[model samples]
Target: MKKANTHLVLNCIIAEESITIEDVVKKTKLSRPTVVNIIKELTEKNIVFKSGFAEYTGGRLPTLLSLNANSYFAIGIDFEYPPIRMAISNLKGEVVLSQGITVDRSFSRNRIIEEMFEALERMIGESGIPMEQFIGIGIGLLGYLKANQGISLEILRIPEWKDVDFKKLVKERFGLPVYMQNDIHMMALAEKRLFLTDRADDFAYVGIRPGIRAGIGLAMHINGSFYGGVHGNAHLLGHMTIDINGEPCPCGSKGCLELMAGEPHVVARYKALLGDDPDAESIRGIRDIHARSLGGEAAASRILDEVGSYLGIGIANVVKLFGLTTVVIGGPDGELYYGLLRDHLKKNIFKNMSGELDIIVGRLEEEMYPLGSCFLVIDQYFKEPTLDL
Candidate 1:
């Protein structure tokens, strides 16, 4: 009962940013004495502190209490595919440390895991915060995850990661409670909590990554809550069929949107447009292709134009299916190519249906994935437990 009251008071303070005991009492419906006791306890622990005095009235002013953002911390790791990233965040959702490691295909999964551990050690050591200060670790990974069982069910070409128990592995190494979720879900959660603060806004977020194998995902925030499907794998928009006789996908579908707009396809298209075997290093990834497009390379621009059209078709389908007016494009590729892709994507969407759709790039970009991962832990730490008789 005491812990619940403290959490309730703290949540009230966190929501208002700064409030007096009278305000907290009214908001939480707790008695004056109960609110005072919880505030005293929280203040002594340095979790809540007096920010300043409230507005001056005719008499004495009330003290304003605010949550100390640095009281506790969480470690978030983005383990989606390669270039695994991590971030340490405070209760305020601010990143204190961030780092990543890109693994070569030649490197075994064991090697990659070792790199992750080493990175964690270095990050913790560098943060100058005590190990006990960290609440837990949050991890976001690609494909479907059995969140309750702490297992990943994604069928991967990487044999070592097939159905791996990542939660157990991380907990064993760090001895901290671990939380896992689909990467796109994490991103959507973070987007809602950190950036999209408006409770009435319903939107769909699309993350696009261009690499050896491209990744595309969708996360929806409807009615102010994440809409994870019954199995938590609802929006696999990349696998949506765009062509009837296009290239086959590993997901056992041909003419998939990913095949037409993914990095491999983009590179293939660019090379074909060049009409010659270009140096392999000249166009390493979508980043490189974006650079070429910026450098006035007609082939790269043409490829982006086509890719945008295909992506627009896919996004249009999502908008119509969900009846969403706002769509956010995110991920590294989205950040780099949004300007180029926006008009094309908009035009294609208008072609499918006439409506005013707000298409924009995600504000968090590359940082959202890791930060969102951290939020998995942060949200749980402050979560108000359910009351059951």
Candidate 2:
């Protein structure tokens, strides 16, 4: 009961930003005495502290309680991209320091782990923070995961990653608790907390990566919590069938959304239309295609329009199913052509449906991916301790 009460009081304080004991009681529905005792205990533990008196209008100025913000720290590592990104974050979820190490699929699994360890050691030494101050480490990787067990069910394109128990490995190495999650899901958590914490509680983040290794992912924040769906495979928006008769996907589906609307397809469609043009040979990636679209290349513009329309169709289906009003398009490829994509996306979304929906480009930097992983640890640190019944 005490543990649950503490959790409630702490969450109330966090939600209100800063609050007096009276407000905590009111918000948490706990008795004033219980609230006071919890606050006292929390302050002594440095989990929270007295900020300042509330106001002069009151006879006895109530002391405002706020999270200490540095009582503990967490480490976040992201392996979704080529570079293994790592960061240290305080209790308030602010990144204290961060670094990235290059480790692609070409490296052996052992080599990747060694590189990560070295980077982590260097970061810890530079931060001057004691190991005792850390709550745990969080890892974000691509593909599905047994998130509760911190096991990698499978990482697409990485042949040896099946059923890897990342949580157990990290815990044994560092003697700290560990959490694992899909990288895109972690990014969605960061998106909600960093950008939309105040404005919206429920929204969706759409991340698109285009290449020989093309993909699209979806992460939804439902009622202020990350929704990973059953089996954590809900993020496989790339495989969402858009056409039953279109080209077959590697996932054994035809007309999958990623095959039709992913940026690599945009570039391919542009080249197919520009047949035998020697200039087409110089067009290497999405960025080159985007430049052409900007320079009024009709072929490039048309391809982008087609891709954008396809993306809108997919996004609209998601919004309608989930009843979400806001959607954020993120990832490197999503951001690069967002300007051109947004117009076509909005048009198609409206064409298919008749409700208001806000589609915005993500404003966070690449580091948000790692920071989002850190949040997994930070969030767990504040939750009520539980026991098996």
Candidate 3:
């Protein structure tokens, strides 16, 4: 309990820069002497320091305390299919340094691990931060993860990662504590901490990636906690069937929403609408589609409209099920198509009933993935059991 209270006090100081003992007491509801004692312990540990003094409106001006951002650091890695991203973050959740490398197909699992370790080693060396200063390494990956057990139950596109004990491997290799979670879940957590702190507690985050191989991903914030259901595979909103007898999915579902609205599908639709035109053949991905849309290509606009309508249907189901007032559409493709998709989503969402629903496009873009992974480590100080007096 004492340790938890100390952590609470530390978080309060971190959240509110240059806070006084009275501020901590009010925020934590701890007694004057207890807050003082905890602050002393934190000051001794060098986790926090007295910054200055507040205005003297009362008897004695209290010493202002601030978290020592350089006292500790954390490493966050987003291990995706092709490119792996890593960042070193300070206690304040600021990314001090970041690096990325693409995985070669010829590389074995051990080789990949070795390369990742080497990159981290180089980063830490470059930053000149001591190993002991790192609290832990947090990893975000695309898959159904047994997060508590640190196991990857199943990962899309990456066959070698299936059934791998990822957390154990990283912990053993780096000799640091490791936390692993679903990439989308980590993104939701990061979004909440970084952007949505003032927003509704119960909302949905839907991310649309570039390919159909991974399809779309979903995460939820419920009652102030990120919800990962039994077996940690709660929000697979992509597989929600939009059409009962439409196209078949690898997951044995028919007419799944991802098949209709994912980036790959949208690109395919654009190509099909344009037929065998050489210009159509040159179009590669969603970015090209967006360019064509901006250039007023009728085919591009039509395809996007179709994709948006399908996406709206999918989002409507999510809203109806969760009774969510806010839904954040994220990922690269989602961000690109936000303007085209907004009207259609609102139309479909309101069809069910009349309520105030805010469907906003996510602002974080690609950075959310790595930042979310970083938050997994940074969030430890603010975890569980409230410091209610």
Candidate 4:
């Protein structure tokens, strides 16, 4: 536990900037002598290196230390969708190397896994670094996670994904500790860390893409403690009713928010606008609209406006429920919707509400989903109860 604590302190230093033994003592609440002893061990290991002395104040200056960025690397990956992305990020979250592949969704499970692992091995080998330098893998995926079994219950409308034990299988094959979480949850964490105040604990994150999901939160200090409700499905945006008689959803809910605002709806709407076209042409159109949206096209702008409204309505309902101040939107369509999602949401929700709510775009994009998964692995390994670092 002491060694683990030492590793944790060094990691914290790396994530933040430089820190002194006093800061470690304060943050970790370890005695100064204990902190000194651990720092000495880390220094001998070459994981934590002395940078310089703190600026002189009144008394003797203290030495500052930080983890060598290249001393350790965390692999972040999101295996939720196609184009599997992997990022080799430093202890400070600076990505050093990244690689992605276009996935053939129809490929056999093992085959796809084999290809992804092969790609990972090649990238790691090309980095010319020892595997010892890696902190293991973190994965974020979009699925209903049965945490006890390490099984990801994912339903992406794609066949051949029934009862899959993703974590156990990946751990067995890769010989690494694996940690997985809901893709949107990880993205929400990254979003909070980047754009929102770190002190702000809870906010709902709604995703609209290959699937629709929500991670609603109420992590306010005044509320006494962060609340996620009993079921952790307080913000079931996909199940929220949008149109009473519009469409049927898989979750036995009719006209859910997701069915209305999600990618399927957008695809349906886009197809309606495009009339009849070849299959290839339709695919191109979807990709093209996203491309043009990225490039700031007026047509794309209008479409996002419509889609953003649906997003706003769903988020507005969340705000009305939890009253949390922030709502983050992410998915494949993140780039297109971020620009005006908040404005539209506020415009509609505030009309009936007394409290002020903030809507923000997700800093973690589609790529971050996999990256979050990788982060999960790295984090749990660091915090593993039995590990001694």
Which number leads on TM-score? 3
TM-score of each: 0.89, 0.90, 0.91, 0.78
lDDT of 4 by residue, 1-389 (tens): 77567766766676567998888878877778878888888788677899999988778889899877667787777665556788887655667788887677678766777888888888788777687777777765654555445676654444566667877877776676666555555565555545655534656666655532222222222233223234222244566787889777766768777666566566666666656656424433334557656787666556667767776776766776666676666665565566646666777665645355655555666555555555555566456256733
lDDT of 3 by residue, 168-195 (tens): 9889877888888778887777777778
Pitting candidate 2 against candidate 4, the one with the higher TM-score is 2
Worst 10 residues of 3 by lDDT: 346-355
On a 0 to 100 scale, what is the lDDT of residue 113 in model 2?
A: 73
What is the per-residue lDDT of model 1 for residues 113-218, given as tens digits with 9 covering 90 to 100?
Answer: 7888998999999999898889999987887768767787873545566777888988999889999877887877777777677634689888886567777888
lDDT of each: 0.81, 0.80, 0.81, 0.63
Candidate 1 TM-score, true structure as reference? 0.89
Which parts of model 3 have CA positions greater than 4 angstroms off? 58-60, 211-214, 294-296, 351-355, 385-389
Better of 3 and 4 by TM-score: 3
Error of 1 at 211 (Å): 1.9
